[model samples]
Target: MEPLARRTLLRSGLLVAATAVAGPALLTGCGSGEESPARSDGKPRRGGTLRAAFTGAGAGETLNHFVGGTALDMVRARALHATLGDLDPSAPDGVRYGVLETIEVNGELSAYTLRLRRGLTFSDGSALTARDVLWSLRSPAEDPASLPVYKNPAATFDFAGARVENDHTLVLPTLAPVADGRLLLCQGNYLVVKENSDFSPEVATSGPFRLEEFVPGEGCALVRNEEFTHPELSDAPYLDGLELRSLPDSEARAAALTGGQVDFAHDLSPVTARTLGEDERFTLTSTSPPYVSGLFFRMNLAHEPFRDNRVRTAFKLAADREAMVESVFFGDATVGNDLLSPGFPDYADEIEQRPFDPDRARRLLREAGAEGMRVTLTTGPETPGMVEVATLYVENLVAVGVDATLEELPAGQLFADYPAYTRLPLAASFSVPTPALPLYQMSYGGQNPAALGWDRPDVDELVATARGTSGEESARAGLAAQRALWEEGNTIAPVFKPFTTAHVPGISGVAEDLFEQFPGFSRATLS
Candidate 1:
């Protein structure tokens, strides 16, 4: 009963969008007086270099996609290697296919067949095959340097039992029935490279851009692959070449864009965005609904003060969400409920917005014998809004009669070590828009450090029920899981905002970029 009905019950990004916060200042990726790529006049001038900047980890950055230390490292890897598939809201199947043309899943949800589009080739003109996909998928499990999340998922995929049916098709038997298997593998991170490809500049990659030069901790020089073609895009990679610059500081990134050193800046701070957004030289942009990031503050249950559920609830109730959104984002973002993945179908957004009530917070604190607890919120501007949100939350805590202070980590060190991050008493984290069930499975499934000590077997069972069912029944199970988590979850997610970036007016055709911040130059043009 293998069927191609994988996208029947759920759509990943194109699911219903959360209602936007009402204000003229709220900017959609293409809306709010900004010129969308589709509305631009004249043809895209196709032969100029597009230069962009993103934060980089000095000396620790690696081209190995399996262990990319910073956003810059991942961005460079995306430029140099082609994707297996990417989550695209506009795609019919919710995934923009790359080398792989189709994913066929069995009725039992126990197996999958990945068929590569025939005629796909690397820069060296070697035929790209199913074995290449197999290698790229298996490397994460075997590579010594791979991150735990990549390495840990190996248990779910029966790579050793997988078989290539042909040069272009591979059949895989799953270790467990994961209904969202396609999303698990095709979520824009599992790129397809030639087997044993060392990822050096000389290695033949299948992406739209070929690496011309690379310097560790710096960035890469890339040229368009004339032979490269996407299954879904027409004459992509409109630029002749691209230059990626590493600017770890958000202000420095914004400065590079304003000073004409680069054409685009990745993830500018809200303060910088407000300064440059109205300027004639730069155009500020954020992605459309459902592409936003969930800005969060988690109370580590492993630590003191936050160990009590009442105290955690008090922390959540004390947040001034409206102030956080208005002050940090300047009204460009949506206020978050206490839960994550609001736009997703099964997120239980019907659970109602968590209100800002320092009175309730104080009452809870009093009842819990913690009316004057001391806690420090460790945060940084990993993205634009984090630190500002932390500042406001700390202020709210002080108002609620708690001793809350802020600790700002350096730009690159906030998440440098996962275990250390989990051990912190109070912290900030963010989540990109993704399906609700899988979103939980990522962190809350087991002892994943990202979960921050949230381990609930009952909730896990509800998620299992959700995944193993379909339609309304699946939604009910998911909602039940979310209901339990929302009422008791340790994280205080305050706002949801798009991945905002500022670019010169001359840059266009990037609204469909894989990363909203670092425009994937695949379809972008520079005039």
Candidate 2:
């Protein structure tokens, strides 16, 4: 398995662009009477404090985004640091520029040259330079050797050959040719921090805002970074400041927005989002397929039953995906076909969608000599509909003659011990739809200590070949790798949930990013 060091980049701007073109028609079925902020005739009125809420926060939150895991951590990280680029959801292939003025990839795709925009500076009055960028890129992989306290996963880039061409330009060499080098660098966690600086809030940041205060498990406050500049977005830091609060419960998050306690809220339940969408006071936004939310069942390949591919196939065949969507998700999601969701680049749609065949599952179980296999499926309220999805899965398993029991962990307790979560014989988890290559690398490729054991040298070679090639050849190789996962992967993704967010009528630019799980408030303005 190849090491996947890619970051999760949210192409929030894609939603904004869609709303701009579709106008009120986008919200026609959901509701009417309220004009979209993105479509409003009046120019954006800046200079106000925007408060937002997200689901789930813990004391473990840290300024070091490389190690941060929660939605709040990502929100704060985006406020404090900027990445090399961001995905453009509006584009057919989802491509966009972020901090980098230009990224030039060689014909073979093994080498990349990043040219930073002129006059870039951090919040602490430090000039942004190639060394800071280099440190940010290399430290995640090299820091464990230099500092034992650092344990975050390193990216798979070949940093040994990195070169600083000038104060504002740097060259990055990949171990193999990479067709999506720009996409890899723009991951949500790949923000740039000052070189040799301790990982603290006081450290200079290159994002649109600087951290003012952060109380783990609670929330944080941010102030505009006066010195920040980017080549893509003309208006930087529209809000005077931002106040982010963590409201883990879906109902609570929706209430916060409705009661005027917060200007924006994320991760609302489908029922709540529908209610809000019908009201004229708020605007609702959603993205599907490649960018949708997903519920997955990970079977530890090291455990009994799962170690047998027949048993795994049995479980996959038995999944009632459409039933789960209608019951658990309230008809707010699309059915997944075991690989990456549709509508994304390089998704393997040709792979046949496994049917909900209980008889076939039973036969497979019998063939594997696992009749009456009683296994415990652990799950938690990690996301909005996770617990419901887990319960539904247990029912499906039992229907196929498997005595599946449910062990529901507390809201955030499932991930308290990272190793424990991965070692569970069977568990329910959730993820947002990300790019195929990065998602495969992060969750399945290499010796991902936290991933369900499903690895093969041939698959790794396929991925490497896919990353090294360009054009149709690249797409063909990538699709082949994904097809392999669909057939033999250890995880079963049955549904792609919508990424739902709600904001007040006056707010614009909140849909500019997917990372924060809300709007990019830096570009947002209150009318």
Candidate 3:
């Protein structure tokens, strides 16, 4: 299929095969139990600097990533510090342990134990122990220096009751029964640091790479910890050095890759992914499902017409999910089922798919006395897919006799003011990949502002039940809550698109790391 014309996005309405051009079908699961395709030239090459281009690597960049607001910030954090772990459903305990070996939770889910791997050391030659972990987790909340990502560790876990039994062991006590404590603790925010030590770039960190040089808004250089070795992180620090360059523009990121200035481009637009993927010189990889962002639209209950369930149902029914995935993403994404987390254990995949039925939608609107209702869909390029998806959805709404128009906002301004954002009758947004229950609790459940007044006490109880238990009991309650939300929720989530990266042929480790969104070169190589 011919590639969609550059940036025009709406030329002949031809849907191209996005993945067909996304290099070879290597089937990399991006750390959810799939191997990255090996470099064609056999054994892994030993040492060279690997350059990567990503946006938000600007002047505001900080080495302390507790409040990382950009992709590059988190990228640097993962590179410079060893993390607790990452949420990986494929793992037996739903996590991939990093510096710490295991997180054992008791039956009631209130008590927990953290066991660190023995013999871990920092770049400054300090022995990494449980005391370091205790300080790092508590000090953030005490001084209140951390950001939104740091909230869970501070708020959920009871640090006051946490005690260190020995150098390698820390026992934690939680305020309540929590089944997914491991996920919360190991979600990359928790790190180890010396007691009472400020997180200075000078201190020995948890990662295998040491910072060599840093210049805000431009880039930074990192040197490998020559003695660093990780049992699970594949051949880490294999490269002698790494360079990160900041290029905020998608076009510029792609240009850098094609121009030989950068060996890898992070988070390209689907259009660029398809274009570069078609080139034989580069290999395209995406983070796996349940890890990708799920695009959604929330119809505020406080808004006119939406107060009527039929109108909300009609608006959802009007969307043509398949066409949006094809035309907007060029078939790079999967169609959402008016719900998020398509493949998660808690996701209600067995539920019937929502269908596109303009006829039914029109009848429902007429029944609700909402025929010819005028609603402005507030959209922006929050992600490459948001505006395009809104455009197509509005067209579908118009087909059902609703006067729907797209109101595009400048990038970064969409959620800059939360009040104005949530006040819109129709808001278009997308959520980064997160576990099912916590994601809803954080964004869509209860009276959360992002929920847009979706208040359902029963659903909340179901979720609470699900979150407090495990195995079959949790699944049953979680599915019950999700099924209710799927049938009547105010949000219209229609597709989940992966975070994509494209690299030159010699790039071998981009898709193997557990943190697939911002890949690390600890295992990457140059030709």
Which of 1 and 2 is ahead in lDDT?
A: 1
Worst 10 residues of 1 by lDDT: 9-18
The residue ranges of model 2 lying beyond 4 angstroms of the native Cα positions read 1-41, 89-94, 142-155, 514-518
- Per-prediction TM-score: 0.86, 0.86, 0.80
Candidate 2 TM-score, true structure as reference: 0.86
Q: Which sections of candidate 3 miss by over 4 Å?
A: 1-43, 57-66, 127-149, 153-156, 188-204, 215-217, 226-229, 233-235, 300-308, 363-382, 401-426, 445-452
How many clashing pairs per prediction, in order? Answer: 2, 5, 6
lDDT against the true structure, per candidate, is 0.75, 0.71, 0.73
In candidate 3, how many clashes are counted?
A: 6
| Tens digit per residue, CA lDDT, model 3, 1-527 | 11222112211111111222244532222211122454567767667777776765345566766645456777877777777887777789888888888989887788899999988888877788899888878776654445444545655578989989999999989866778778778765466665666556576776768877666565667778754557575576667777776665555566666655567778878887877787776778787787788888999999878888899889889999999999988898898888876766677887898999889999999999999999999987655677788899999999999998999976445654556777999999877666787766666554666788899989988887888887889899999999998878898988888888877666676555667766666676665
* Model 3 / residue 265 / CA error / Å: 1.1
Q: Could you tell me the lDDT of residue 173 within candidate 3?
A: 91
**Model 3, residue 14: C-alpha shift (Å):** 33
TM-score of model 1 relative to the true fold?
0.86
lDDT tens digits by residue: candidate 1, 188-306: 76778889988666889888898776655555678888668777766787788787776677776765565455677788777777877777667887775577888899888787777
Model 2, residue 262: C-alpha shift (Å): 0.7
Give the winner by TM-score: 2 or 3. Answer: 2
RMSD after Cα superposition, model 3 = 8.6
Error of 1 at 458 (Å): 2.0
RMSD of each: 9.8, 8.6, 8.6
